[model samples]
Every structure is written in structure tokens, then in C-alpha cells.
Target chain A: MKHFAAALAVSAALAVPAFAQDGETKVIGVSIPAATHGWAGGMNYFAQATVERLEKVYPNLDFVLTTASDPAKQVNDIEDMVAARHVNALVVLPFESEPLTGPVQNAKASGAWITVVDRGLSVEGIEDLYVAGDNPGFGRESGEYVASALPEGGKIVVLRGIPTTIDNERVEGFQKAIEGKNIEILGMEHGNWNRDDSFAVMQDFLSKYPQIDAVWASDDDMAVGVLAAIEAAGRKDIRFVLGGAGMKEMVKRVMDKDTMIPADVTYPPAMIATAIELTAVGLVSSAPVSGKFIIGSVLITPENAEGYYFPDSPF
Target chain B: MKSPKIQMSVVGPVLALVVLLVLGASLNPSFLAWDNVTNVLARSAFIGIIAVGMTFVITAGGLDLSVGSMAAFIAGLMILVMNSALPSLGVGIPIVLLGMAVALAAGLVAGCLNGILISRLGIEAFIVTLGSMGIYRSLVTWLADGGTLSLDFGLRTFYQPVYYGGLFGVSWPIIVFALVVIVGEIAMRSTAFGRHCAAIGSNDQVAKYSSVKVARVRLTTYVVLGLLVGVATILYVPRLGSASPATGLLWELEAIAAVIIGGTMLRGGFGRVWGTVIGVLILSLIGNILNLTDLVSPYLNGAIQGAIIVLAVILQRDTRQGQ
Candidate 1:
């Protein structure tokens, strides 16, 4: 099975050139957030890596990648790409939802194929394709793991990410998954998806409560902070830390099956790579990629950890 | 007259802290716990230490938007240097000491660079530091490849003590923060250089006429700011055992906020070291209070924090005017 998977990846990588014969070179514009924080950094990494791979596979395809620190700049960037770059297809992960909607709508109006990654624009149906990781599933998967791990129903706490619609959905799904179970949630607080903030919040959790069976740090960066806090406090009661987003370091721990971090959930920053690849394929071929591509959150355990691990990838 | 300025500088924040403490304790009894209080203080050390340097800069009529990125860059460099040293040096006392030295030196250099650009070259401090912020942030990102620069596992356990260790009952960070505050207070309040800084900040032409060597005084303050940032980074790196380019994000603003909240003027000519310490405590306590009470939705956390800062500044203004 492992060999089959490797073979599949190799063939899929090689298949892009063979699949694209659109007669002329097509320019693809990719816009994503600059490397301001960990996840975006990873997104930027994967976006560049995927572009490199695709460019080699399909020499006739040209790519223009633009990273913006803010929404207004991103709008200006997208406008420039559409007007001057003469982009045949546009792939964007918006800095924010609402502000980018009208700009994206204008980009769409220019007749370029639109593929939006990660964040969805406020106005729906603006893009020809939408690609995102399952945030609610990410929360639910984490909750379900804890539920089964502690079948006797023990007390647990949660450290949420920044309060966004995504954060709300993740928390809602988490609460929904753990409802009526033997688990008692001791407390929940926002870590703002930051390592330092998570460390502080975890410290408070440890001090406030005497015993906590487990902790769900919704993002891996926060989980790193949570683990540090637990170690510093010298508390052995926390059975495992469940952190999502498949950061390389955390996933490596899961691969090694570190008792402190036994598992992780996937909300990959590389989904941008996936969106770009699919968009490129669509632009080259008659592939029907107009629908939403919702990437499922997979529970990364010790058994299948190597497949998810990317030692070279930044995230 | 002395008492009035003290009232303007220190009393308001002290009172604010006392009222906040009472409110926090009433809202949640755990907010006043000894362990939690130390935790908040230890965590605040990063901002508190950097704000000390910022006090000098602001008091010298300068601002550094690059301190946050500078801290991140320094920490990242320290970790990389330490990690590279581990293979040959081993994770012993020497390696740890070497890492600390590298951190301080990096901080000094980064600070000097900022100082020279702003003071000697006559560039606006704001623009220079702003450009340096991008440079430092990007340099770290390039070094980490947009991921994390983690220390060697062998060194992690040995060096964790710097942050978690204590002298007596106080956490190491709290002790360090106190020492920084004490030394900073003396340097800013009782020394000739302190007066020169105030003089330069008050009026450069007047200071020049008074033989203050305005540029030299300004340059030294930036160096002080950078050195303090280095000190903060040394404490910060151990807590997480790694440094990301994202480390110290927006810390410059936080440090400045603490300085202003502590009653330092934005336009310069005043240095309030102890007041800045109080400002750090107030902000730290507010975060603690927020964490303890979960009733405030996390979505409103930023809004609530902003409101409190505005309220504290308003109260300070009213007190200063009355004084």
C-alpha cells in the first residue's frame, strides 16, 4: 500500500504535463498572505513549492505569485494581475473575507477562471472553484478522539484559536462532538492561535484546575505553547495534547508517538498547493473543477504518520 | 512640586492597578492566586524588559517600531547559534553561556545599527526602525524558511531553567524584571546621562547650546533600547524552546503602550522608569483578569483591551491636568 501511494504521487506529478496541451502558454496568478505568522508562512511555502513543481511539469504554463500583507494591497495586486499580467486563471487566499469580495468579483468579471483558497469570500458563488480544509471536521475529529480515549468520561479543557467564523465553527463542532459523553469540559479560552498566548492560557488552566485528563489546542502553534506550559508546571496528568493544522514538528511527535502528543488533526497550509494544482489542471484541460473542494480532516496517528510528514516543508 | 509630577507619572497607574486587582479578585478569587500572579509577572517580563529601553528612547524623543522584529531576529539568531554549537560544545554550561552571550551581542549590534541610522545619519527614527522591522522580520523568515527555529533537544532541558528557575520564591523572570526595573529607574532618574537624554528630548537646539552632544545622547538611548531587547529575548527563547519569525509580533506597540500608560510622554522630555514598570503590571494584570474570567467572549477581547487602554490614558490625562 505504501509503494502504491508513492507510485500514485509520482504518476500524478508526472501526469500534469501529459494532461496539458492547450496550444499556447497560459499565465496563472496566485495571491496569498505574506509570511506574517506560522500558518500563512506554511501556505506561502507550499504555494511556492507547488508552483515550482507545476512549472516544471507544464513548461507552457506561467505563474505569477503575489503576497500581500493587507486587504487593500491584495485588491490592488489582484487588479494589476488581471489587467497587466493578463492572467488566464487566478488563485487567491484572501487576507480577509468581506473586503476582498468586490475585488474578487471584478477579477471574476474579467473572465479569468477563479479559484479561491482557504478563506471564502463574503459573497458566495463568486469563484469557479473553492478549496478549503474542513475546519468543523477538524474540531469534531479532535473531540471524537478525546471521547474514545477517555471512555470513562474525564475532565478536559480546550484552548481555542483566534475568534473567527472558523474558530466558532471549530468550537461548535467540538462541543457538539463531545456532548452527552463522559467528558466534562473544565474550561475553554481563546489562545488567539499564538504560541505565547497559548502558553499563558495553559498556565492558568493548570493553576486553576488540579486535574485535567487532556487538552485540545486547536492549532499546533498553540499546542507547542500548551506542551511547554505542561512541562514547566511538571504536570503529568495531561494524557495527550491534540493539536490540529499538521505542523511538521507536531506531526513528527505523533509519528514517534510521543506520549505527550499522541495524535494530530489535519488543516494543512498546503491546501493552497492543492488549489493551485487543480486550477492549473482546469485551465489546461476540460476538467470539471467548478465545485467546492472540501478537504477532509484526517486523524494523524502513529500508524500513518510518515505519509503526512514533510521534513523539508516549512510548516 | 516633585509630588505632583510623581502623582502625574506614578500614582494614577498604581491606583488603576489597585482598583483592577480588587475588581479582578472579586470577579474571580483565583485571579489573586500567588502562582497565577507570578505567572502573569513572568509572562510580562518580555514586554516589561523591552519597555524599559523604550522608556529611554521615548524620553529621548525617539520611537522604535522595530523592537518586536529585532527581538525575534535576535532570538532566532541565538537559537541557530546555540543549536549549531551543540554538536561540538555539548549541551553543557559553556554552550548555555555562549548562547546567552551571542544573544546579548546580537541585541547590542542590532540596537547600534538602529542608533547609528537614526542619530548619526539624521534619518527619522520612525522610518529607520520601520524599515529595519521589515529587514529583521524577513531575515528571520529567510533563516527559518517561514517555519520555526527550534533549539536542539539536548539543550532544551538544560536551558529551560533560565526562565522557570527562581531565586527565593520569585520566578526567575520576575526577578529579572524587577532588577531591570530597579537598574532602569536609577539610570533614568539619578544619572547625568539621564538628564542629558531629557535635555535632548526636550529641545535639541537648546540641548546643543547647553553642550549636550544631542546626537550622541540620542544614539546611546537607541543602543540601550536594543540591548534591553536582547535581554528580553534571552528570557523569551527558553520559555518556548524555539523561535519563529512570528516571535515578538507587535511587541514594539505593546512596549510603547506600556511606556505611555506608565506616564511617559509620547513627545519626549520625560522618563518614568517605575511608572513604566507599573504600566507593564497593569497591562499584565488586565490580561490575567481577562483569562480568569471567560465571560468576555474572545471576539471582544481586542475591543475590551482597547477600551481599557483608552480609559487608562484618559484618567491619566485628567490627573495630569489637575496636577
Candidate 2:
């Protein structure tokens, strides 16, 4: 009698309606950083917005957005999202490189096409398509801009972001560019990508160094903190305070040609959008779309600041 | 009551600060600049403000994890209110006062939620605020649509004067932080609530039997904490054009660090507002010096922060044992 009842229940479960998209559901999974910071918040916004738009455009494609605030949660999320059998393709912006390798590999092994954005994975042959902004380029361009403007190479104090791979890459790239030049990096400290932390860091930079020709505030958010501290100090020695990452306010400063902010580095948040588009085109079109994808990092100065400016969209 | 204990508390942190300076200057002479000293005090204001509150909660036998997210939520709300009213009210004194009032009220509500849930509901303050931390953070993310809501361009200059403008050659945030310390000191010293607070921390059941309204004390303390956070946000918002989800990330940790390092007992028995001020300053100074000198790699900065926090706690332990 129990066996008979179990059989009946299995039949009933099979009869339930499918949750997948109607025409021919091709599951697409999205993994992004949890909406912890403003940038990640915008990243989540773009991911969700694009998923909605894509579902409307393609009847067969169903998208699932998963957000994790930290590295471990992201790894677990990838595992859970993959195990649900809800995806034919996966797009991930990893929280950290080391911990996410196995999960991305597992999802790829399960026959899902893969794309990794922003932070890269440690596992090779995992990401079928990769989309990313150039950190080295971010550092090089900002460094080059500094070199050109300060021909004689003034004393520069650098305020770094949190100690991550991205931070290391940016600093390495920057140092490489300024090598053998007159430019001296007076000091460097990690502001941990926090505004108040950066403010304190910049303040110490000012005090520890009697004369500073300029400042490189690696990220725009940190730049805000650095600028506040500098302004509070009321020092005139800083001819320029450089910031990167194409934040809206930083872009605005570039447009206004604020004496302190003459240029910026672009690390567009729309890379997720780019990854989605490429993945969709691969599924929909006859063209070969499976390959490594690289997006150019353009330097934004007074001339091109307006083009990169998005007054409505939050960065 | 004023004895060798008070003087001992004063001597240790001062020695630590002086030693840190000596070490910093020896490593890099540029560390003694006027600008840097000013910078450390200025940036330490935020952590200092929150730590002052944590000093109360911890001494009172409670902890608050909601501060980081609560501060961000209040900042976002303050900005939204300020921007909405900018057009209706002129850029005169009234709008500024009104904006500050709204910010403070928002903080009180947030704090009240914390106080009510823990004190009244009999829930652990840590777990209660931790849940609220997620809730408040998510709410702001939803409100912002995961982006930033900056001040409208027209009102940027009008609003900026609050942060940029100074009285007596001191930044507004610094001045506000100072007043918070003074008020916190007075409240914890002169008020009836103050005496009761100590008795409660020392022995909750005993204090309860002594006719101290235990629940009311705990609840009101949170509200006061909320008010201070709100005030900090008010002074802080003008410096930044927008409020995003990252507004107060890890501030709870920093504030806790300041409290722990400031000689406040984490297990709940004592809170020292002035010790917290010095603690915040010392913590802030480390970050400043690190930025000024390339003595250590940037990656090791966290190690430095962790080490300093441990050192402060150890010194406190030593002092306690000696007493």
C-alpha cells in the first residue's frame, strides 16, 4: 500500500507545471557580488535589469540572478544555482579568485556555457567566454597622465584600495609606468576602499610628507575621502589629486576641468551587460561567439568626458 | 571615586600615542607635519562618535551590530529629505536645521527599533541588530536601486557649506564629535541615569532591586546612540555628494574596536567616552602614518590594524591586573 502511494505521489509531482520559460527554456545563471557597496549595488541593478529585458526579448531564455556579499557565499551560491538544473549558461562576477574555481568548474562541467566578468577565476578551461576591464591599463593610463603633466615628476603620495588582486595589479601597473622617471611615490597605504579610512590615510600622507606635488587616490570612492581630507588640511601644495574607476562624480570633475581632477580611468560597470549580450548573440546567431573577450579601457579627459558621462544612470 | 585608576587610564594611551609617533618619525621624518595631525583627528571623528556610543552599550551589558548599516540608512534618508525640501525652502538657516532634525529623528527611530527589540522582546542585542543590519542595508540598496543618489547640482554649493565651513578654525565634524564626547561624559557622570548605568553594568539584578528602571535605561541609551550617529551623518553627508550601500560598511567593527581598545569592558560593566575618543584618534593615526610612509606594503595594513587592536586590549589587561 505504501509503495502504491509513493508511485501516485511521483506521478503527481511529474504532472506539476514547469517553471522554465515557455518556448524552449535555455536557462541562464547570473552570479554577482551582493549589493554591499554602491558599485556592487549598481552591478546588481544592471544584472537584474538586463535579465528582465533579455527574458522579454528571447522567449526561450530564462535568467536567474544570484548575489553574494562575500567570497564564500558566492561560492555556495554558484553551487546551489548550478545544482538546481536551471541553467544552460552562466555569467559570474566572482567575489574572490581562489575559492570560486571549483564551483565555476562544476557548473561548466554540467554542460553550461560560462562567462566570467571583473574578477577572474583560478581554474583554466572553465570560462568559455570572458569579459573584463583592464586593471593594468587603469594603472598605466593614470600613471602616464601623471608623468605627462608633471614632466619633472613631483612627489606623489598614493592611497591604495583594499589589499586584493585588483589592488596589487593596479599598483604594479602604476609602478611599472613610473619606473625610471623622476616621479617619486612618497608613501602608500591601503584605505580599504572606505571614505573615512581614505580620509584618514590621506591626512597621514599630508603629515608624514611635508611637501607633496600630487596624490593618486586609486579609486573614485577613496578619492572622495582623500579630497575631503586635503580640503580640510587647506594645503596648496597638491596641484592635482588623481582618481580612477569612472565614477559619476569623478567624471563630472573631469568635465568641469577641476584643477585637481584633469583625468580619470574607466572600469565600466556595464561589463556584465556586455557579457550578457555576447552570450545571447552566441546562442541566437550563426557567428562564432565563443572566445576570450577584452573590453578597451579608455582614458577620460576633458575632451571625452562628456561622452562617457551618464547623467541618469547611477555608476 | 577619583583615584589612581583614573590617572592610570590616562597615562597608558598617551604613552602608546607618543611611542607610535616616535616610531613613525624615526621611520619617516615627514610624519610630524601639521596637516597630517589635523587629518588624523578629522577622519577619526566618525569612528570616535560611534565608539562613544559603543562604550555605553558594552558597559551597559549590550552590543550593537546595527550601527554600520544604520548609519548608512540614516545618511541616505537624510539626503533624500534634504534634496526633496531644497526647492520649497530657501538655502537659509531653516532648511539646514530642518534637515538636521530629520536626520536625528531617523536615527532615533532606527535606534528605538534596536532598543525595543532587544530590551523589550528579550532578544539578544547582537542577533537582533545583526538581522536589522541586513534589513537596513538591503532597504537602502533597494531605495538606491543599487546606485548612488547624489545631491542635485543646483544645491551642491548650498549644501556643501555645512561641511566645508568651519567655526574657530576647526572642521564641523570635529567640533560635533568633541561636543558628543563632552555631553556623553557629562551624562555618564552627573546624571542619575549615569549612576544607575554603572550599577546596572556592575550588577544588573542588584541595580534592578535598587529601583533603577533597567529596561528604560537600556532603551534610552540606544536612542542616545542613535542620535549621535544621526548627528555624525548630518555632518558627514555634506562632505560626500551621494549615499550608496557602502556608506557605513565595517563601521560597527571599527567602533567596537575603538571601544575595546579604549579600556571599555566588552562583557558589560564599564564604558568610557573619553577613552574612546583617544582610541579612535590612535586608530586613525595608524592609517594616516601608513599612508604617509612606505615602510610596509599596503597588503599588511590589515595586519597592522589587527595588531594595534590586540595591543590596546593587552595594555588594558595589564592595567586591570595591576589595579
Candidate 3:
């Protein structure tokens, strides 16, 4: 029974590629981290919307999108895409750089075009197209905004995301941008980019510090927590809060010119859409879509908040 | 000398908690202030309440890894139900009560499902709960469409008092947490149900021969735990007024850690409610102290917490060996 099952599985695996050769259709497998938080949720939304939109535009393109909850699962997902789907192009927003490197390289070895999104693989020159939101620019844009917002130089606390190379890059960019600007950083702690953790951390920050001029929450989700903590404490000293990653609710507050949330920085989750669209374009058309496409992180204030607001996006 | 040593066994967790308090207060002046103390206690309330239920579960040789995801899933359902009913129920106490009912009902059903699967189907508690954990987490993520399910603004504001407000100087979460602990202590100490759980956990064949109805007792423990998780969610939803996939992440681990640190045996047959409260406080205080001062790198926060939890268990172990 076991031998028969193995033979049946082998034959089924062989049957998939044979079936794919019947048409001029190109298959693009898009792998991403699961929607465990706000930003990833938005990424999932945009990826699905883009996939649906592209399917209508290009009749000969097939798409397989898989969301993994962890790095090992993501690696398996990439492997399955290569083994089962026989994808012409593989678009992946890797969960982590190191573990996913070999799996992505294997996909590349299978003669499939690789579009690495957001997180880059450890090995260089593996991905044919790389699209990512600028982490350094995300931090620099936020730092520049802070420096401009507090021209007179005031003390601020920072709520960082989970510890990672990405977080370190953003913090380094922020510190570099704020150098010589006379802005004093009171403290920095990881909020893990979640609301509850930030809420508790912000409350402790409030208790520890008698007076804080402003807060750089670094992400909109953290900003929401920070703002709530301030409201609960009824602290009037905080002039404004600067949160990045333009969440729809935060962008809406900025659009309305809320005093507490004066402005936001953009680390749009829609970058997933860009990678999927470009991969689709490269598969179907003659457009050269191989190279790094870095989406600049822009500041959203009352003036430009309207353009960044996406009521439909979950984030 | 033996009596004193036996007393010291019970004092291990309390002594550790006291040390954390002193360390926190010494590091920051405001650490012992009423506001800061309340914040820490209120934050611990969610885990503290769940840990109380967890004490019973662990005492009965059962574990529910699904509590965290179960809380998240219940919160999501509560928000969805309230939002959809807002047109008819309106933004008032009726809507808030309705949301609470939904939370309790969902938690009860979820808990019952796990209990039946484990007790009736004769499945291992760990495997059953592990499966339910993934199921609940994924269900919430799917229900929210991979986003956050936020209660309507007006309704959220109206429902805020359940978490933020109190009768005099205490917050609702803290009050609810204290009540649950008191009731849990009584149930675990005086009730026949409690002895049945311990007996079953110690040896199920022996318990059955002793006519304890081991399966019924096991089922009740899970049902009770589910109800308390529901209670915790009632206060939790009002605080954030939203539920996402990130809500209550790793909470089961925290609750389990607190239970084990409080001297409840992971292998079962022993439990403590007040000690679990002390354990919960110790865990929260570690995070609070790490945030209140810059004594160590923020990256070392988890390492510090890990060290303390192990040290706490070791302290209890030494006292047990003395016995």
C-alpha cells in the first residue's frame, strides 16, 4: 500500500507540469507573511486586490498567492510553488532573510523569475526584480519631520518596532537625521509594533517621565497606543505625536488636523501591489522590470493626508 | 524546624514578588505611586484572571494553549456582533451588555468544544489544545479579513467604562481580577470539585476507582476556565475597543508561566490561586521595571524576564526538596 501511494504521488507530481504546457499562460506565485498585524493585514489586502485586478487585465497570467505565519512555513511555501505550481515567476515578501535565501534561490534555479519584495534575501543577485519600502527613508522622513516640528528642540520618547535588522536600520537612519538638530531623545524601547505592548510601555513612560514634549511612536499602531496613554494620563505637555506607516485611521486624523496626531510618515503596505503588478507585467509584456524599485517614504500632513488615505484598506 | 521549612515553601513566590516590588521602587520614584501601581495591576488583570483558571486546568493535568487565541477570537466576535447590532440596539448599555453576552457565550462554546474533544474523545489535552490554538487564531484573522475589527466609535466610548472606570479609586479590570481570584481560591480550596481534579490528576485510574467521576470533573475545569477567559475578554475589549490578529498574542504562555511560577505543578495535582496572583505581578513588574529605568539594554528585557522566571521556580524547588 505504501509503495502504491508513493507511485501515485510521483505520477500526480509529474502530471502538473505536463498540464501547464497546454497554453501560453504564465504563472506567478506570490508568497507573503500572514496577516498577523495591521501592516501585514494591509499587505494581504493589497496583494489580493492587485492579483484580482491583474487577472482581469492579463488573460494568460495565472496567480498563486500563499501567506505563511512563520519563516519555516514561508520556505516550504516557496518550495511548493516551485515543485507543484511550476511558476514562471515567484514573487515573495520573505518572512526572514536568512532561512528564505536557499528556498528562493532554488526557485531561481528552476528558471523562474524572482521578484523579492520588502525583505531582501541574504544572497545578492538572486532576485531579478526587487521592490521595497525604504526603511532608512521611513526613519529619515520621520526624523526630519520631528526636527521640523520641534524647531526649538524638545525631549521626545521613541517606541521602536520588534528588534531586527530592519528596526536597526530605521533607528540608525533616524539618529543620523536628528544629529546636530538639538533634539533630545529621552528613551527608546521596543513596542514590538503592537498596540497593547505599546500601550503598556507608553503608560510606563508617562509614569517615569514627569514631562515629555512629544513622542515618535515610529509606527501608526504604536502611535494609537501612545495617544491613548496620554489621554488617560491627561498629560497636556506633549505637543504632538509623529507616527509612521500611514494607517488609514491615523491618516484620517491627520486629514482632519487633529492636534495630538499632527502628522504621519508613510511606509505604505501597498508596496506588495507594486511587486505583484511588476512581476505580472514582466511575464506578459515586453517591459523591462528587472531592478530595485524603492518607494520613497513620504510625510503625510494635513495638506497631503488626503492622497494617502485609503478607507478600503484594512490598515 | 520542619514546620518553619514547610512555611518557607509557601513563601517562595511571595518573597520573589516582594523583591521585584522593592527593586522597581528603588529604580524609579514613581514606580510605587498610585497611578503607576494601578497601571501595572490593571495590565496584569487580564493575565491574572486567566491564570486563576489556568491554575485549575494545570491542577487537573490539563492545559489549554488556546486561551490567548480564544480571547482574541472572542474579542473579534464581540466587536462584530455589537457593530452589526448597533442599528437596532443603539449606542447604549444595551449594546455593551449585548457585547459582553456574546463574549461569554463564544468563550463558553469554544471551551466546551475543547473539553468534549479531550474528555469524550479521549484525546491528549496538549494536542487537543494545540490544535484549537491554531484554529482560534486563524478564525479571528479570517473574521477580521486580516485587519482589525474595531467597535463603533460611539459604542466604544460608551463601553469604555468597563475597563477604564471604577467605583472609587480602582479600575474595573483590577476589581474584576480580584473578584475572580477570590472566587477561584474558594473553589479550589473548599469545593469537592477541587479535590476531584487533584485526585484525577494524581492518578486517573485511582480517582475513577475512588468514584470521583474523573471525566466530569475534567470537563468542568475546562468549562470554568473558558468562562473566566470570557470574563477577561469582557474587560479587555473595552480597553482597546478593537481586536486584531495581534491581540492576546502569547498570552497563554504568560498565563502558564505565572501558574508554574506560583508553585502549581506543570504535571498536575497541586495549585495555588493567590500565589498565581503574586506570580502575575512579578512578571508584569519585571517588564515595568525594565521600562521604568535604563539599567539594561532593552534587548535584554526578555533575557532578564527569562532568568527571573527560572530563578523563581528554582527557589520553590529548593523549598520543596527541604520538605
Best by DockQ: 3
Estimate, for each residue in A76-98, the C-alpha lDDT of model 3 and write its tens digit: 99899999989999999999999
Off by over 4 Å in 1: A1-23, B1-9
Question: Distance (Å) between predicted and true CA of B54, model 3?
Answer: 0.6
Q: Which residue pairs collide in model 1, if any?
A: A153-A182
Q: What is the per-residue lDDT of model 2 for residues A1-315, given as tens digits with 9 covering 90 to 100?
A: 232244334433332333332335566788888766656655665676676666556655656677887889888888888888557889999888889998899898888889999888887778889899898888888888888889987899888877778888888989998887899987777777767668767767666666999998978888888887778667899998888778887899999989888888887887888898788777766777777877767889999999888765667
> What TM-score, over all chains together, does every model reach?
0.93, 0.90, 0.96
Q: Best by lDDT, which number?
A: 3
Candidate 2 TM-score versus the reference: 0.90
lDDT of each: 0.87, 0.78, 0.90
- For all predictions in the order shown, the interface RMSD in Å is 1.5, 2.4, 0.6
The regions of model 2 sitting more than 4 angstroms off are A1-23, B1-10, B21-34, B153-156, B318-323
Superposition-based RMSD of candidate 1 using all C-alpha atoms, in angstroms: 4.5
Q: Which stretches of candidate 3 lie over 4 Å from their true place?
A: A1-23, B1-3
Q: DockQ of every model listed?
A: 0.58, 0.52, 0.77
Measured with DockQ on alpha carbons, how good is candidate 3?
A: 0.77
Query: What C-alpha lDDT, on a 0 to 100 scale, does residue A32 get in candidate 2?
Result: 89
Q: In terms of docking quality, how is candidate 3 classified?
A: medium
lDDT per residue (tens digit) for residues B1-323 in model 1: 45455454456777787888898889887777877888889999999999999999999999999999999999899999999988899989999889889988988899999999998999999999999999999888878877888888769888888999988778888898899999989998899998998888888899999998898889899888888888898898888888887789999999999999888888898889988888888888877777777768766777877877777777678545643
